[model samples]
Target: MKNEPRELLNNMFSAAVDAAQPSRCIAPFLPPPPRGRTIVIGAGKASASMASALEKIWPGELTGMVVTRYGYAVQCDRIEIVEAAHPVPDINGLRGTQTMLDLVSGLTQDDLVICLMSGGASSLLSLPLDPLTLEEKKNINRALLTSGAAISEINCVRRHLSAVKGGRLAAACHPAQLLTLLISDVPGDSAVDIASGPTVADPSTCADALNIIRRYGIAMPLAAMQILESGAGESIKPGNPSLASSDYRIITAPQIALEAAAEVAKAAGIPCHILSDRIEGEARDVGKVMAGIALQVARRNQPFKAPCILLSGGETTVSVKGDGRGGRNVEFLLSLAIALEGEDGVHAIACDTDGVDGRDEIAGAFISPNTLDRAWKSRMNPQASLDNNDGHTFFGGLGDSVICGPTLTNVNDFRAVLVLPKSADHQQEN
Candidate 1:
């Protein structure tokens, strides 16, 4: 029996999310109970949820704290959950960061530090480098959000500017056994790039971070400039023995999520193809490229034949130059609809697994063959919307916004394209 379209789509998307959920991946990587105390620490959108999962599975005595985005907290008896700001630093986050740092300031080789790491850790654990006030960090963060820098570039700058990031936190707990459970959100899942790799070794140099800051034309506060110039806040270097005891495990990743979706497609009698899970850049540009790929598969059959789905995952950025609300996923959908204007038998959906895209309430947008046609009918100009970087508004106007509201676990973005066979009448005649 042919599966209902929406149900099939939901199943695929659900599989993608389930594949990356913390519960399924965290337990296997857990280390044997440390001889000494087990102190759990983490930061990210998924931090609290990860903590909860650990609590459910862990049978030993464990106590610690982890910072999570405000309203994203999960209750735990042993592990304290501190709600904080994300994508921008707030005083609460600063204080929480200090608390977390203090938690590991004195640990022995026998102690265990279970680090649950994921995306958004950078902002969630906001600690301004000394001499730089929290406000200064906020301004820099604001500028970076609007700077169109890639995740790696943004993270490079953040690692240099932060106090607990770039492996310094783990270094503080020298001699302790550090087992880092990671949910890979960045394109490459580089520990140094995810949440700025708070307790992980960093290969990024001070020079690389400075270059990104300058390239983005961010005006720094006097204190920030001084900290960098003095090199007073260097991260753990590659050979630092302080982090030698730390072990890393990827609990969930985009590739794993995409494969789950592919499996669903196969089970449903639908062909599946996954584009690069590492695609990045401006949201609109990436959307255009994806649209082109979809058109090829739909019209030419040069790649996989019809009855196929394209699954992809990655974090995309938007350089916000307008006031209208923007989200990377929504922008991608708009660009895609415009590119595929009126094309038959193609439908797509793009959403952030975290359920919040660029400060917007909606996760993403959906597109059908008539998406562009409907926009025109409603007197909406697709190009104008694109020009303003207002994808959230465009999709909202059509009531097509995918609102999932903080799935409580994040694995970056998910995109799917469904292609059906073209009519024989429309087939190109030789």
Candidate 2:
């Protein structure tokens, strides 16, 4: 009763983001000084900050390039930081990725290649394989995003189309000691799914990419299709000698962030249930399932009693059937609002840890028991907005959207539903 539900939710979110920042989690994982020149290359929202952290304590010469989202760049003296478009590939990203690939090429056994890949790398490092133009890669990327395909599925296609993704980047560093450190933004923390596993062994084949395209009905450039069908786009498979000497590890992941948030709740004397850090599905559907659990806790206290928080993390997808502004976090929160129907004793927040959800700069939104009622009074039709995929506008009108621009970390989505029980709410109000 001492901390309001909304404030507690916000605190938990901040804790989650703080736990994943590069400076907080990158130091202990830094490798020892390499024998030869150390070339660092990476791409993601966190790459620039990661590079900066490495430079602060690195004993060896650090020189290389890393691509980050347009506004997420941090000052790094040694590594060149290239700011580029994210969630969508651009010419700048393409150039940066090509340069990275070139830097790792022609390395000797004594040379070391350090990769710092994270979420958004799949788009930030966008050099298409030959015979496939950048324009073609861009088109397929757009399609996969709107096609409601899962992150792993989308990344599979990206790996096959790119010259730098999959295990090819590590392959390019053959004979050199290649070490990849990632801040995982994909569910299950599959090494092969994080930024399409640029420096890890990829077990997926070109056939898997073709299957995803067909399953999603994604239209690919004829040239790309031909490459896949002819097996020319096949990714470097497991057991490939090029990756045999490479080492890969995740320094930060969704699970780590979620557990950090859970600790905050525990210290506050609130029982916290960490359901999973690998949940995935359509955002709205996941919202409904979450609402059901919250209802049980509120009305029956079957799973967890009052004054508890249910925490989860992972990337969720949006099919984007409507013409409205769509951020997966907002989409999930909106659907949750509708399902809960002003149900008392339940308050929740959903956000992407990176501070950008879907295509918007807005991180995400929040929902309270009165969310729907407030919207109805303001003449905002929640259902209509949801139908148009306009959760941002709907939440914005109510001044409930949680906007924390450019947290500069990517661990995927964070959702917290606080079930207070009727007694706690009354106590807080009094």
Candidate 3:
């Protein structure tokens, strides 16, 4: 019996995520044990796992703290694990940020600070600057998430607003040799963009943050706006002596994840075309463009023949016009399904490698030739759901939502579009 295409697609996704797991990738990049104390601290979906991975091979006694999104924590005995909100800031995250700051303060040159930074760290390390409350930071964060601003720009704002982000954490560890290992989830894998570069020097400024806020029309509190205007939130620049002893490396990224998926396709005798690992923009628009490419491959075989996978990885943005509960991956899948119009010989899957999409529990959703038809049969209006940004409920109605709780790793979004020949129509039903 031939393996099901959907199973293959799921396997490909698993491969992508597995390639970025902290345990597999973090070990090779681990720095040597310091001559003095080892203090580990981090914030992100994968930080907890990274800390746990560090504990296994680290030679000396390690004491540190890492904050991750709620429900994404892995058990660790020595290093404390704090679970908080993601894409949004909460009180727990605020308190955890202060504690993390304290953890690094007063360290001497003999101590070593290892920071495990990854995606979602900005929100997980939410400590507002003076005169800026956590509530204001949360409001700004929520606005930025729905503002269609690029991740880099959102992070720029985050760096300026926080007490622990944008190299501030690294600066706090001054005199202590700081090493940062990252699992990149941003499009370009800019170390400064990952977790707002908590352990790396930031080149962005308050003026840049103000410009982004203005460009996106994001409503900001007066005190926060004034802080940006007064230049009080200016981040530590590249030449800052406070960060002179810091070093960083991106242990894993979207490109690596996409390559892993491609290898899986190769093993299965399927031609895989990695369209791009840095595709960015509106999710629905990106979906439409991807749908067109898949159509061309199916109808003309121009780019490549059937029995191939068009894979792309990048973090897409969703300007929330409707009050719906769906992450960028599902939103893209919903839009792709609508654009495909139930075309035969095509199937697709979109999911975040971290196993959480937007603020929902589901990772993402699936798209098949019958996706639209099934929705119609179920009396679910796909367009209405899409309009309301309710792809979660839409796909849930058809039982197509891919739910795999926290995968404990993140390399950004993984998308696969499988186009088969007419001879393989039987596989579409399976």
Clashes of 1: 0
Off by over 4 Å in 2: 423-430
TM-score, cand. 2: 0.97
Candidate 1 — worst ten consecutive residues by lDDT sum? 421-430
> What are the RMSD figures for all models against the true structure?
1.8, 2.0, 2.2
Candidate 3 or 1, higher lDDT: 3
Q: Could you tell me the C-alpha RMSD of candidate 3 in Å?
A: 2.2
Instruction: Please list the C-alpha lDDT of all candidates, in the order they appear.
Output: 0.85, 0.90, 0.90
Candidate 1 lDDT, 60-115, residue by residue in tens: 99999999988889889899999998778898889888998889877998899999
Q: What is the TM-score of each candidate against the true structure?
A: 0.96, 0.97, 0.97
Worst 10 residues of 2 by lDDT: 421-430
Candidate 3 lDDT, 1-430, residue by residue in tens = 1457888889999899999999998888877888899999998999999999999889898899999999988989899999998878898899898998899889999899998988889888889998998888888889999999989989999899888888888899999999899999998888999898888888889999999998989999998988899999988898899988999988999999999999998988899999988889999999999999998988888788887899999889999999988889999998999999987878999999999999888998888999998899999999999899999999998998899989999999999999988655555554
Residue-pair clashes per candidate: 0, 0, 0
For candidate 3, list the clashing residue pairs, or say none: none
Q: Give the alpha carbon lDDT tens digit for every residue of 188-274 in model 2.
A: 999999999888878888999999999989999998998888988788888998887799879999999999999888877889999
